[model samples]
Target: MWYNIDFYIWAVNLLVIRLRKPKMIAFVKSLVTPIVNIHYDFLQKKAIDEFILNHNGQVCYLRKALNDVFDNELRRIRIGSGNQYNRQYIYTRAEQKPVYLGKIYIRDKSAFADTGIDYIVYVPKKILASRELELIKWIEIFNEAGTAYKIIGE
Candidate 1:
């Protein structure tokens, strides 16, 4: 009876081992590995994407950071238009047209040349008075080395 009981216990252990789902564990691992790898790849590439070199070989990650920062903290400020030359709209009264005099003219100086400045941070009048120096220092700290920037109030 003791030998019979020991044999039965061994058989039960073998059956339990056979019942264990190794395939299911492998399937779960297969399903999860790609997801984990994709997230890891994205994190790695995100760090790379944040850094970029300018024409002068200076690291200009601030261009990307500035976009994010401006979008979040400085809603009233915007980067100037044009990649080659910065552009801005000016409101002025027409000097030659008396019939249209006193009426505000929105002028676009399309012939403007690049001013050798790298980045133009345009701030609305109200914010510029209060934060000009702060914005300048922020740009100085983050902008590419030796790059010039202007803070214009609109």
Candidate 2:
């Protein structure tokens, strides 16, 4: 009968709509994902910048520690173009020439710490063995204060 055919058509249409509803929603969500990601990235960058700004003062302390001259104003200068490694300071004592030493990398503790980075000193390739224990001890002090450090080099 006509009524039975109409009912079948109506049921099929309802079934099709029910099946397609979630797929349509997923497609729309996929389209919005890029925009959501951009916003998330923007917010993350802002938070990181704020965190860096707040914690950059630790750099001076790090410089003083690395230079082993707490009293002297640290004159740490970036070594290469990128921030992977940098000379924390030049220790020029008594008759010694300005050594191209005191290099260090105060890298990010994690990509997620809010203070930008905790006490994790990445050791450079050329630190003197004599200074290694001292450096480790110094880093240990910070590490004990809930800031962990590691010695990584080539």
Candidate 3:
């Protein structure tokens, strides 16, 4: 009876450890990277503020732009879920279709190929286009909605 109890305890402990691993990893990842750290406060603030103002504080524009450019591709890739971390948002479109978006770190190339972000909008080009002004306005709306944004480049 004692031996059975000991084995049961050990099994329970192992199960607990296993269940905690993913949460621990996610926590560690969050701590290692400062989500809001900005090297140039002024620049970051201005960019963020401008984006908010330009977008008139709407988050839908980002989704719209993404859908417009990559909805079909996402469907093709079969990535149908998304994970959010700070200012970074990842979308996986793997339900009936397959498309993965955002910074995906996959160990297997085949898996990546099977499910990857179909379309990527070039920031600079989007910024330079005639529609830039409109895009900025939309981004500003998102800001007003209290959404944090991360500018990839200076």
Strongest candidate by TM-score: 1
Please give each candidate's TM-score. 0.35, 0.28, 0.21
Selected candidate, larger TM-score, 1 vs 3: 1
How well does candidate 1 score on lDDT at residue 62?
A: 50
Best by lDDT: 1
Q: Which residue segments of model 2 deviate by more than 4 Å?
A: 1-20, 58-122, 126-154
Candidate 2: residue pairs that collide: none
Q: Write the per-residue lDDT of candidate 1 for residues 20-131, one digit (tens) a residue.
A: 4766545555556665667667767766454422222233345444444444565555665334433544445664433433444453443244555555676677656776
- Scored by lDDT, model 3 comes in at 0.39
TM-score of 3: 0.21
lDDT of 2 by residue, 1-154 (tens): 2312333234335554556566665665566667666766777887756543443225454544555422234333211212233324555587587766554556553423453344345445456244677666544453435444445442
The alpha-carbon root-mean-square deviation between model 3 and the true structure, to one decimal in Å, is 26.1
Q: Report lDDT (CA) for all predictions.
A: 0.53, 0.47, 0.39
Ordered from best to worst TM-score, the candidate numbers read 1, 2, 3
Tell me the lDDT of model 3 at 121.
27
Worst 10 residues of 1 by lDDT: 51-60
